[model samples]
Target: MSRTTPATLALDRAGVAYELATYDYDPKAERVGLQAADALGAPPGEVLKTLMVKVDGRPACVVLASDREVSMKKLAAALGGKSAEMMKPADAERLTGYRVGGVSPFGQKRAVPTIVDAPAAALPQAYVNGGQRGLQVRLAPADLVRLAGAQVAPVT
Candidate 1:
């Protein structure tokens, strides 16, 4: 599989340090992020799943550990919005310029507000999608927060 992607390019442009990892993506897996963590043999907490959401009807991005689930109520509160919900799969793909399972917070088609779960943000290293299926980038959570301009919150 190709190692270069818009996600990597964005990181490069920002001078963010990260390592690329590739694995066999399982389309049949019920949870993409869990499958990715298993494929990487890493802790579930260190594998972040990028989710596209609409907070108060506005597009937003959320990054949280693969093992956790987002609390929509908490998410809304964090964003100072009234409500939050997952974006439609197709809508998410369209908005982020990536397929459902390959969406990454970086290099999105449009810049949107981003929230990183407090737990994930505390990790010294985390793995996230690399703008494509079967690819992930390992980097410090600090770098991810800084690069994505993500707000850290307990939304999960």
Candidate 2:
């Protein structure tokens, strides 16, 4: 088998069954979710993206549907932090060792606190970035949470 990325490797090591999908990447694209959905034939809502944010001066990860936006106030309150703000793309890449379009909850350089939108847990499976811009991993919601050591909350 070919060597997988850190994110996919972590999922495999954790015994999480996932399907890897690769697509042609377009850097100028605005809606990554729509692009992925169109390319992979998955629903926009079922494909998730990992976002990096700062909560009370600490870096954290928020997983939400690609079509939705993260409510900073709700996220901060859920995390018991005073405020939350989106991390800069460069900062996110530097911290996670993955580029902006390829951030994944698993296999980050640093183990940051992670919160997944409650609705994501209800999905049968979700497609998330596979630690690389051109790749994605589809896995069960339970497995994703287990692999990422994420907390379930209302992140959307």
lDDT by residue (1-156, candidate 1, tens digit) is: 778878999999999989999999999999999999999999888999999999999999999999999999999999999999999999999999999999999999999999999989999999999999999999999999999999999997
Pick out the ten consecutive residues of candidate 1 with the lowest summed lDDT: 1-10
Write down the lDDT that model 1 would get. 0.95
Query: What does each candidate score in C-alpha RMSD?
Result: 0.6, 1.6
Q: For model 2, how many clashes?
A: 0
Error of 2 at 142 (Å): 1.0
Report the lDDT tens digits of candidate 2 across residue range 30-126: 9887788778888889999889999988999999888889999999998999899999999999999998888889899999999989998779999
Highest lDDT scorer: 1
Which consecutive 10 residues in model 2 have the weakest lDDT in total? Answer: 1-10
Cα deviation at 38, candidate 2, in Å, is 1.6
Off by over 4 Å in 2: 1-3
Q: Which candidate is the best by TM-score?
A: 1
